[model samples]
Structures are given as structure tokens and as C-alpha cells.
Target: MQTRETFAGLSDWQVGLWYALVAVSVAIFVWGALRLVLKYRRGRGAFPTDNLFRRVARTAWIVLTHTWIRRRDGVAGLAHALIFYGFVVLFIGTAILAFQDDFAEPVLGWDFWRGPFYLGYSLFLDVFGAGLIVGLLIMATKRARNPARLDYGRVDGVGSRYERWRYTVGDWAFVGSLLFLGVTGFLLEALRIAETDPSFERWAPFGWIAGQGLQAIGVDGETAASAHFGGWWVHGVAALAFVAAIPFTKAVHMLAAPASVATRNDAARNRLVGLPPNPVPEEIGYGVVADLTPAHLLQLDACTKCGKCHVACPAAASGYPLSPRDLVLDLREQAEGTFGVRASLGVEPLFGSDANLLGNPIRPETVWSCMSCMACVEICPVGIEHVPI
Candidate 1:
């Protein structure tokens, strides 16, 4: 006989509410994403679209394998890989469940949430969810233990902007969201197991353990059912909020990073692309955010702020005012206008300041500090080219 769980004990009204929340979340995400696209479109130059097939294949390989990240820091890279893959698998599992609930059971009159296949899926998700939590914990611990590890070295003359402070709020928020998702997910599963008292509880080993704990505390079926419904709503809303927040936050790097890698220059690594013959003198190097190409703007958005570029930079290590990560962040601030009052007004000339990048945000000394060694470029896992920029 097949078991019927009523999809985590949600009522018809609750289901409708969940769908409404999802719609709103998706709309917010789409609007934010479109705004970002328009910002990129405002950039100066065109992106190369040559070698279509090659680009696609390269992007897939880099994103899937995370080869660039793995090449630099093995332990951190492995943790990142685990977190990434775990999230992917969990997302896929959620999609499958949605398909089963909304389409398969109603329209097709079929359900796959039974027998060996369902058991395997449950076990897989359980294991990966735990792995994801562990990976996040490791990253958080590293950040806490040695904050200077992110700095690489200190800047001599510059103040707070060049100095590596603690992790930003965005960093904490991103990590916190993931941790909440993982924990709440397992809690929801445990509640479900307690409510349903499934014979196949053994298949979901983690959930089963949680359910046994709840039972030891004398949680009745009625309480378990109520808790399951509450958890369902909380987890669902949190998941949707996290998705909606992506385009507006540093989390967008999840998409931008691989893209920066895949669409990176195909020519010689160190060789700089020469300017067009008889070009205007003013068109030499990037002076401001407006001078950059759309692809360059996208690269700016793609930065993970890992500070590996700063670490590898000879200039930064030598106590010069320039940190490659700081340069990128400054440019990004100008591009996005996340800091100033002009941003809230939705005014033109993104930076809104008459002074060029050379004075305030980036000093002449800082620009001169660069040795053109390509050390930052070579070490950047996301393929950011600080020297060229």
C-alpha cells in the first residue's frame, strides 16, 4: 500500500498561500535581474560572441568541475565544491518533489515517491544536506580564526578601504541563509517522519534520527503534524526569499563567476590586447566605470571577493596602497553606486562625482603601484584580470 502524507500536512489554503509567496518572490528576482542587465547595457563596449559552441562547453566544464578553485586552495576548494554540488542536488530533489506533487499525482495519476527509488533519493538528499552544512561550518570557522588570511598583507599609506576589515554583512547573510535552509529542511523532514510514522523511515536515516529524538521528548502525532505545517511554511518562505535576494546581492557571483571564467580572453594569458590603430589618445585605459565594456562590468559583478587576487599581488604583499580586490570593489561600488545617495535617486552617471577614478576611489599612486606582473590575473579563480582593467 502507498502512503499519503498530504505534502507535509499543508491544507488547501496553505498551499495557495505558498504559491502566492513563490510568485511574489519570483517577480522580485526578475525585476532585480532586469535592472542589473540594464546597468550592464549602459557600459561602453560590446562583448565577443564568437565560437558559440566552444564557449558553452567551456562554461559547463568550468562551472561543473570548479577546476580553477580546486587548482589554488585544495581544502577550501573541496569544501566549496561540496557545498555547490550539495545545493545543486537539493535543488534537483525539490524540483522532483514539486513535479510529483503538482503534475504526476494529479494529471498523470502516478507517483514516484515510493519503493527503492524514493528510498535512494531520500538517502542522497539527507547525506548531501549534512555535507552542505559541514562545508559551510568549515568556511565560517576559517574566516573567524584567521581574518588576516583574507587580507594577505597590509597597505602602508591608505586607510580603511585598503585595510581588510572583518567579513561584510552580505557574507554573513549568505552563509546564514544556507545554514537556515539546511537545518530547517532536516527539521521539516523529521516532523514529517514523526507525523506519518512511515515504515520507510529507515531510508531517511538523518530524518529518522531526528524523529526518534522528537519521540523521546514525547511529541504526539497532533503536535508533530502542526510542527510539520509550520516548518513547511517557514522553510518555503525562506527559500523563496533567498532566491529573490540573489540578483541584488553578492550571491549573484554564483552565476557571474563561472561566466567570467568561460568568457575570459582566449588570447595569450599575459599578452595585452593592443589598441586600435590611430585611436583617440583619451581611449587608452579605463578611467572610470563608464569607460568599461559591458563584459568588463559583468566581470566586476562576478568577483567573489575571495581576496586571492590581493594575496597573489606582489604590490599588495610589498605594502603598496593597491590591493587588487580593493580596486575591483571600488570600481564595483562606482558601477553599482551602492554607497552614495545618488543611487537612491536613480540618477545618471553612476558615480555622480566630477572627479575621475584616479583621485578619490583609486589614487594615482595606487595605479602606479601595479607592476603589471599578472600575478592577480593568474591566481584569480573567477578569471578576473586586474592588470588589464
Candidate 2:
């Protein structure tokens, strides 16, 4: 029988410190997330409220099946689905461990990490961890091999210098953090097995292999223990940091994407909602980020910058100035206050005589290039309405 330990060899104070760090991280995440929510509320648009249960069911199905993604790119969709399911399982496993260590054993005088349950849990995590790794590698390789393939020719001349830099940096940071989290998780597992010499180590196939490799390299008991401790702290800190950064990074898509999918207007897929007959024409279309409705602004945050929209965009394929992906990124940068002078206050106007999106970030030619074909809208995994926007 395998036994689990709570906080392992850490002192009470050290454990308390960990909890404190988690609390602080959670608070920061909440504050940032709330700011985003409040900002969205400042915009003017209404989402559908009918068919609540149906919407929830549909959203769940879409996420589970990767339906929209698979519609066009089957292999990439499969890779993403693997990563998503693996992450979900690993998250549930983490919750279970937390419950067992913090509440179950201490309050209920019971533990679940033993015998059949322990073996099953260990095996599941090991298998899923490998899956997550493979998925990440596939995505990373695709991005590296065809970095420019997603560019809609707009990013080259559009947006402020700061905006461009921020997008580039944020993209790398998001990918690097996820990769770090996945890799370090497996390393910590391998180190733990090596240090403890667990009888059930073989059940954790990947960890067992890693442990054997480390052993073959002459990693002794004391060295393994030290490395395990270091890896544990590194993994824990990285996880907490990732959580804290979610509201400010591309990871916000994880929450916003599902909501976007659930709230999408199925009736308006092919048809652009006609403006009220003979409406006053102050701004014929979106001139800036500020011109977008609340729902549209929220959709910007939901975008994963996956470039599926770009790939599907007719204008982009024709070598036009309009890349739906670039258009979204430009608006997203302004929404997040990454451009222009008022960026520090997070209230920067996206368009002006000098900073107009129509002729500046997005050229007049780009605005006219949109055929309103809805290809981008139909293929967007997050349900972003590029045609409508």
C-alpha cells in the first residue's frame, strides 16, 4: 500500500507560508479579473439570456469535443483536445490531493490515497502528464516553424511600437509558463519517486522512467533529496505565478472562451444584423476599441490569438491588409491599454486624429477589404465575430 504525506518534510511555518502565498496570489488575480469585468461592463451591449441550460450544455459539448477546432484542422484540434483534457484531469487530481491533505485526513480521519485508489490516481496522472507534454511540444513546434504564417500583414505596420512589443512578449510569456509548468511537474514527480524509492513507482510509468534515467546518471540519495526539494519549490512558485498572471495574460482566454462559445448568437452566424433603417451615420463602423460594445470587448479578451481567424480570412489569403487576427490583436491591445500615451491609466482612447484605427492601426484599404464573408466568424474556435466587429 502506498501512503501519502501532507506537506511532506516542511515545517509548520513553511506550510503556513505556502498558504499565505496562495492567498496573496488569489487576491491579486481577483483584483485584476474584477478590473477586466468592470471595464467590460463600461461598454454597451447585451448578451442573450434565454436558453440558459441549453447554452451551458452546448458550451460543455463544444469544449469536450473541440467541435469548432476540429471542423477545419483535425490534427491541431486533436492536439488541443488532448492538452485540454489532460489539464482538466491534472487539475482535478490537484484538488483531490489538496482535499485529502488539508481536510480529509485532518478533519475526517480518512485518506483516499492508498491501495487501488492511489495506484489509479498515480497511473492517471503519469499518462496525462505525458499527453500534456506531447501536446505542448506539438503546439510549440507549429508556432516556431511557421511564425509568420498567422500574420495578416497588419501587425507589420499597425499599432504602436509598445503595443507590438507587448503582444510579442505576452505571447512568449504565456507559452513559456505553460511549458515550464508541464515540464517541472514531471520532473518533481520523478525526483519524488527517486528520493522515496516508492514500491509503486512503476505504476507511474513516466516518473519511473525519469527516475531510472536520473539514477543511471549517478544521482545519489542526498542529491536526489536536494533536487526534489528545489524542484518542489520551483513547481509550486511557478504554478502560483501562473495563476496570478491569468487575468493579465492570454490565459484569460481559458475563462472567456467558454463564455464566448456559450453566449454566441447562432441566428446571426451568416447574416450581419442590419442597422435600424436610416440610422444616423456618425461612425459607420468600429473606428476604435472604444466604439465596440461590451460584448465585443469581452470577445477580444476571449481570443487565444490562435490565428485560425487569419487562416480562414479571405482578405488575409488574398494578401490584403486585413488580417482578422491582427485586427483583433490591435483592438485587444487598446482594450488592455497597451498603446498610446494614456496607457498607464488603462483608459487610452484607441482612435483619434493621430491614432485612428481606421487609417492608422488598420488602413482604410484593410477596412474596405473585409468582404463580410463570415469565414473568420465561422471558423473562430472562441466564437469571435470578426465580420461583425
On lDDT, the candidate that comes out on top is 1
In model 2, how large is the Cα lDDT of residue 39?
63
Q: What does candidate 1's lDDT look like per residue over 1-389, in tens digits?
A: 43345455567887898889889998988877777777777777777688978988988887788787876688778889878988999999988888888899899999887777788888899989988988888877766675653643446465655443433667778888998999999998888778767877777898889988887797749998888777888888899999998887768888678777766886525777789789896677776667777777778889888888878888877878888888888787787773222364475435663347778578888989999888888878888877778
lDDT of each: 0.78, 0.77
Each prediction's TM-score versus the true structure: 0.91, 0.90
Off by over 4 Å in 1: 1-6, 151-156, 160-167, 338-350, 353-355
Query: Model 2 misses residue 93 by how many Å?
Result: 0.8
Question: In model 2, which regions exceed 4 Å deviation?
Answer: 151-165, 276-291, 338-357
lDDT of 2 by residue, 1-389 (tens): 68556566688898999999999999988877777777676554556788999999999999998998788778788888778888888989999998988899889999778888988998999899788878878777776675564332353355444344556567668777888888898887777777777877788999888988787897748888799777788899989998898887878888789988887878546799777567666445665556666677788889987788787777777877778888887677666663222353546444342245565455677778899889889888888888778
Candidate with maximal TM-score = 1
Clashing pairs in 2: none
